[model samples]
Target: MRTLLLSLTLAGLLLSGCSPLPAPAVQPTQAQPAPPSPTQPPATPPQPTALAATPAAVPSPDEATPVAAPTSQGGSLPGGAIETLDPQAIIAATLRPDAPAWLIPADPELADMTRYRLDVTLAPDLSTLTGHEQIRYTNRETVALDVIYLHLFPNLWDGGLQTTDVRVNGQPITPTLPSGDDILGLPLAFPLPPGDSVELGLSFSIAIPAGEGVGNYGEFAYQEGVLALAHFYPTVAVYDAQGWRIETPSPQGDVIYADASLYEVTFTAPMNLTVVASGATLDHAAAGEGEAIWQLVGGPMRDFNIAASADYQKVSLQVGDVTVNHYYMTKDAAQGQAVLNWTIAALGLYQRDHGPYPYQELDVVETATSAGGIEYPGMVVVASWLYRDPNQRDFFQSATAHEVAHQWWYNVVGNDQLNAPWLDEALAQYSTYLYYLDAYGQTGGQGFLNAMDARWARVGHAAKPIGLPVGEYVNREYGAIVYGRGPLFLVALREQIGADKMTEFLRQYYHDDAWGIATPAEFQTLAEAVSGQDLDALFQEWVYP
Candidate 1:
């Protein structure tokens, strides 16, 4: 158990900006951040050699009694540790109880989840990509399915994406043209019954737009030597309570959601280019003529992302069984190390409070994103600008901690972000407060909250509900509500519920929702249960109203 490398000097510096550090006064709804002033790209440094060839040994389990897994409407969830359960008793005890049925199956079979195996090639100049994929999708819903939907999210960019030769189980199938939406509807020859799986095959190509990213969002285009690909692939759409999430891309906030599944993705690019993606790279081989192939395996993860560059220098630090890696250029080595150090500390704090991080490796890479950073499952992409100025080190540390918290909130505990932005963003923001409080002392944490209050009073006081969708808030109100006031609501909740009980409530919530989606209603039910207090008025004033 290594502690965060926090020194009094660094703590003093981090305490400077009490408000959400570095976010614009009027923040954009989308995560894309305004580009920093252009600076010459730094030369890549040599990659760090492996320090130990063997995997780090796992720590002995703690001596405390293992808490029994919480019971749900069902007797016991699949993969959950055995525990006594009385569904009716649990339901009757809650203040704001949800329906008896679980949103997703209580015992979802991982073998029946959607899985993808992709082999893709990137252009030498990083301008284009050609890909072929084999998809295995299951109909986990109760109803028979007539159509399969694939979201070509990258089409939201200029020049967009092109697809050809689509097939289902090796038989040729015609895909309906892009339906003015980002969806590609593939009608099955016959209805696929529930609990059945379908194999889909497709080939497509994408042209990477070049230039500064749009609307605080860094462009998908090639810049310096890096090519960032977020929604670059045709992702499967989630079928949930609202039906397939086929909403067109909006410049503000994320619009994608899918069930966690397995991925075996192989990316081919110029031999000199280094590919960093959601999962660990399993193999790398040269393809001759200055090209190579990198094979990756990731998931049970919500989504997969790839960021490749020829100039990335890599470093790693070991914490328990997990290895934290930082990628940056020579000029940004200090900043990259700063992110790594903060990530290690945040990871420790979150695992202790929430749950253990299941992944073996966590990556933090320096790239150009519209926002200060974006969280993937096991990896995070941080804005290159944060590494430029030494004076901005505190902001850099804050942003890194915030995104690392997302590994628990958004990545593992999936939520319908499009519908309830606060469920993840607000929780992640509040977790940052916990990190600072635990890392620094009470004075430092209180100061951070004071800054947030100042910002909220100035701009976010008019926000309708803390749980509104991304579209409901305009301009800085998104940050003010989702990031600022939303967390304040949690702080207020902690005030009502004793601190010890608050921690117990969150741990129970995280444990119950691990590897599953959680709604505000579900959270409310659990909160009341853990605190032994009816929270109707509190939730109404801060959460719903």
Candidate 2:
């Protein structure tokens, strides 16, 4: 989520020396995990393919365990291998038969990735949601695991999430919420060895808060007949060299840090409302009287998001095999069309420079958000206020371009957004610059660069390191530095390396890390490799802490 302060008026706010109050920081007391052994090398980059043509062979029944389907009451299944699940069955269940070729995972390396199947229903008033999720998680780490952690992100707001009926492998289990209400720890019956997999079933109910006082960009709130549900479910946490990342998040930056996974969602909503969500809509039909059900599939992507409104009007255009849909209020039809145009332009430029977008559908929805824009896997939420204010046209364009660029940096090529946000956010900002250069030519590109200069000026051109964690910066520093000076660092690097090398570096980095998590070390290594110039001094002066 790009904060609201990225607007052109931020320079005036900095001149006035007034900033939003900082949220109190909650420091973690948990000991950090030891570093990886020296003998282990960094992960090799994956080939630039989306899905494998033929599925991997399923495990033999002798090697497989029986898994039970989740019951509505959250009861445990009978203790036998009554039903068995394999990778092919899970993939078939999650992916739509009519899904485009690109959405299928061609790379055999992604066979063990996590898969989620969700069945949820939204209240007629849009005040709450109740659902059950079945998660198929593989122990991708080298070391064995005794527990699994899940993040309940909506607990950070006034409303909260209640989880119940937790089961692992058809047996009931009690999970612990140790520190913050956001993290849930499930103790396994036994250690899950490396290369092993586990099935987790749980039921959750969420109280949707009103948008006014909801913080963290209000991405999870419901307001004025519009619902923006981001991270509305209990999502599994990523385990890295630092151990389970259950730290309480700072309100200043994006909340989720997760790997690419497959999602099959069955959502039931009021018939009057129109839904815009991540992924392709495989099925939409009447569920019952006055209600409708939508079956959607998205995958090998980071996260799933949804936006719904009874008053929404949509405009769509086909770009190649992908469809671009823009949803807006009835009164803002012209502005909605403009947004659609800009989105298509940016998407074309990004596809030319970066790789093709992996999904078959892209949605840009106008919802009530505190930030300029918030990006999910295949969808983005643009602030509704931007469409009403004519004076904010430039900010509107900048925000749209920035969020579309995230399709390449954040969704297709994954990163640890909580720690190394610059890997995506800074790159997205630079990609927005490329959009202006491609769409509007030199004059418009120079105008956008001047805005970047003004943004960095808000911090008085501070030489602060850009690689620090999100919590390390307080108040306006997070935006002023990460969103401001962070992009300038890329511009400087582009000058040091020739423009041609910089372009190749961006393309290579996208292909190499497609559908995988990236790190600061790997980023620098790739940049140096592409340029064939030692970037130690450049990173030391600009990026390193």
Candidate 3:
């Protein structure tokens, strides 16, 4: 299977800082870096061509398995074997525990997880974030390693971060050129071979990300005292079948599965300031004076994310013994109930249908600027203006549903969002529609179907074959093929097979691929196999010919 590519384009992020790696120190013994050249817009590279062959001789039933449907046919995704499951047991298990603990493949160069900690400071006044990353990499591989490479993540930022210095276990490493790229970027890189369990500490800074225009985020806008802090720290890059999944720009959010880390993140702000973040907070007491500590202890997240708003009003609710907190600017509080009500409804439906909420607390905040509602592990940040409109419930409802569903699709049911975007994006978008169907019946679903219809009408005109890798198509075109056409195919297939059977098939698919990623072709194969039908031609029409 082709290695998946995942990226989060936190572009148009407003930043101001000097050029180079970052002010914080990086791993030492590095090559010497050249003087900073004038940074310019990067030219797009030729898209990837097909690597695996086209579909060949059909598989015999005796040889048939879900794996053959996708991976063997020039398609990507590990397409690993499927497993049977008990639905009741799956539902009863906590969402965190329910995920498959994907075994770390026996790789010779990398070490297993030991422990990690990160301290990051964001300077709103400077629009720059300073961070310190600490991790223990033990060389479990047989080879004796020398140099190790580290990734300064969220490298997809428009201009990327510039590091001023680096230290290796406190020893400084020189550089040939600033260790990075424009198209696919990671701020710094280190070298490592084998049998070395060592600690890596790095100090780096990225311009505080804001969107294009003033208060403009991707597809959303910002309000007062609201801040969206993302890709704000140095992170370990991913290397797999496709090599280092470095600082590349991808349309969808990132596809990450960080092993484990103990995080002690602190935010110091003046009094009356409340913040909502990714992990647990150590609030010794609820004091209502002076500056407060927004301390976080993130247990198992690939990266840590947090949003702060000094003007935010705090509200809390409990859903099934799990506390759900909300932070929004005071002025936006007028419509806070609207979001809270819908979120509660969506949460209840998701738990009943798929699984339980995994984390102890779920935070929903209104960011100063951000894309449409985006989910981050247990927390979610969404635009408040959209939800405030009483008539715009469909947009709010669906966005809310989409982000929440991401908790299951990308977070637990892990898949690479870059190279194989269709895997999670399509699932999250459509699942929201499913939730709408469950809640408001056919009418609620019609809006999404209408969106699909609009997407098809717009994209079908330019009808590029969906067979090409996701990055080959325009962002909008990919949306049409994956989110619109893909779900419509599923809806049609469901009609062919009774819902009872289809639901069972979905359950099985979920159980089998819990921690695994997938490709579109594999899904077609599974749908056919589960329904005792064929989808070859269907895929030919919708995805490839």
lDDT of 2 by residue, 87-122 (tens): 343345434345445545665545678877788999
Model 2 TM-score relative to the real fold: 0.84
> Distance from true position, residue 521, model 1, in Å?
1.1
Q: Where does the lowest 10-residue lDDT sum fall in candidate 2?
A: 54-63
lDDT (Cα, 0-100) at 271 in candidate 1: 71
Please give the CA lDDT of all the candidate structures.
0.66, 0.71, 0.48
lDDT, candidate 2, at 242: 93
- Give the TM-score of each candidate: 0.81, 0.84, 0.68
Rank by TM-score, descending?
Answer: 2, 1, 3
**Residue range 21-111, candidate 1, lDDT tens digits:** 2334342234322221122111121233453211212111111112223343221111111122222221122101221232222335556
Q: Which stretches of candidate 1 lie over 4 Å from their true place?
A: 1-108
Top candidate (TM-score): 2
Q: Which lDDT value does model 2 have at 42?
A: 16
Error of 2 at 520 (Å): 1.0
